[model samples]
Target: MEVVATLAGMSSSRTEALTPSQVRSARAALRALGRAGMAECDVDGQWAIRADASAEHAQSSATAYRCVHDQVVEERCEYRAGGVSQWSVQQAAELKANRAREQAWWDGLEAPERAERRRARQEEFAGLSVVEQERVKIELAERRVRAGVDEAARHDAWVDGHTMDAWVRRSIERQYRYQRLPEPLQQAKAAAWQRHRERFGIARGTPLATSRREHAAALPSTAAGRDEEFLLVDSGGRTTRRDVETG
Candidate 1:
């Protein structure tokens, strides 16, 4: 549920195609749509905003398309051609197919199998040390964020009618949202996230792998050794601690 902007015909002479005010207004409108679960919008910024700029500022008068979903080709106003671009369309289709496969796999699991799966996961959670358990909690929290972003991305892909990389990057971006920070700090956090993703080889989001039963046998599967303390990160990128009674 986010608006993805694309300049149909862009030029380097201009830092932005639309006026600063227009960009702000359009962005606000798109966010409103997201909140309401609205699908598509054509702001006609190319006509309204482009009319004000001279040829020197605007590369061309090509229509600027802003979609609630991802766009296949991100035309920067460098040069816009008339014919339809095919790359983005193909990507979106692929993503949908992949998601369907994942859903099917989950739906095919039997009741006993699912119960065993849940048992296995709890065992894995219990096996970690106190510190590792805390880390896993953080990871799970981030995964929740990723799920939301995926929904937003799906909206974008459908509305824009184009292909795009999965919205995995949103998980990292959502972390600094609670408070405004200086540019340097923002850059520092982004760098830290990059290192973490690389270290863990988790640039893309996926379902967790099931641990071998033999390995899980060594771990306590019940709540006996579980710590009640949980670190939670909310949608606003705010962090808080909560302790649940294991009893």
Candidate 2:
């Protein structure tokens, strides 16, 4: 069962409303009436009464019961009545209808009117000098070009290189000795060396041989693959030799 209550000290007039204590008493009475299966009733200028009644009669009696109940409870509770604004169901319905009508009126406008408004905005923009328009266009073009270049660079970096396997082989060969490398690795190393020399503008003939020789001379005497019996003489006249092997 549902119960409705009227606050006490609340004015029956919309301008001033009932007090909290009055509302509490009203709520309690409504609750009791609901539990007892009785509807609250009121006669003008009399105390509120609870009675067993039909639903329709109960609903109709609520207004009168609320008015008398609020007055009596407010008097007994000595509570201050507060102001309230009231709106009828009809008034609320009218407000909603007015809003919907306004929205529909806006929606009913012709496409041409909307287009005209858009064209007016465009005309305002077009009224700017030609040089300003050109400047704006140029800025937009530059921004697009920059964005295109950045996208292209990102795409290129993401692409897998066609020569990645060959490059890996060359790298392995460089780490190990070329003579000890497998046939495929050896070819890769040679290709890599030629490519490097070409990139650095080095001649592929005698000059490259001389460079390799000079590189070999820089290695320590104890380093592998050098002739062990060979001697190196320093500027101070000190001589060093590779140790002889005996079997």
Highest TM-score against the true fold, candidate: 1
In candidate 1, what are the lDDT values of residues 22-52, reduced to their tens digit? 5666566555544444433448532222114
How accurate locally is residue 161 in candidate 2, as Cα lDDT from 0 to 100? Answer: 37
**Per-residue lDDT tens digits of candidate 2, residues 108-220?**
88989877877997787567554555455446444433333333333234332324433333333333344455788567646654554443343543443344445544544
Top lDDT: which candidate number?
2
Worst 10 residues of 1 by lDDT: 224-233
Q: Scored by Cα lDDT, where does model 1 land?
A: 0.44
Q: Which pairs of residues have clashing backbones in candidate 2?
A: 7-23, 8-19, 8-22, 8-23, 9-18, 10-17, 10-18, 10-19, 11-17
Clashes of 1: 9
- Where does model 1 exceed 4 Å of error? 1-89, 129-247
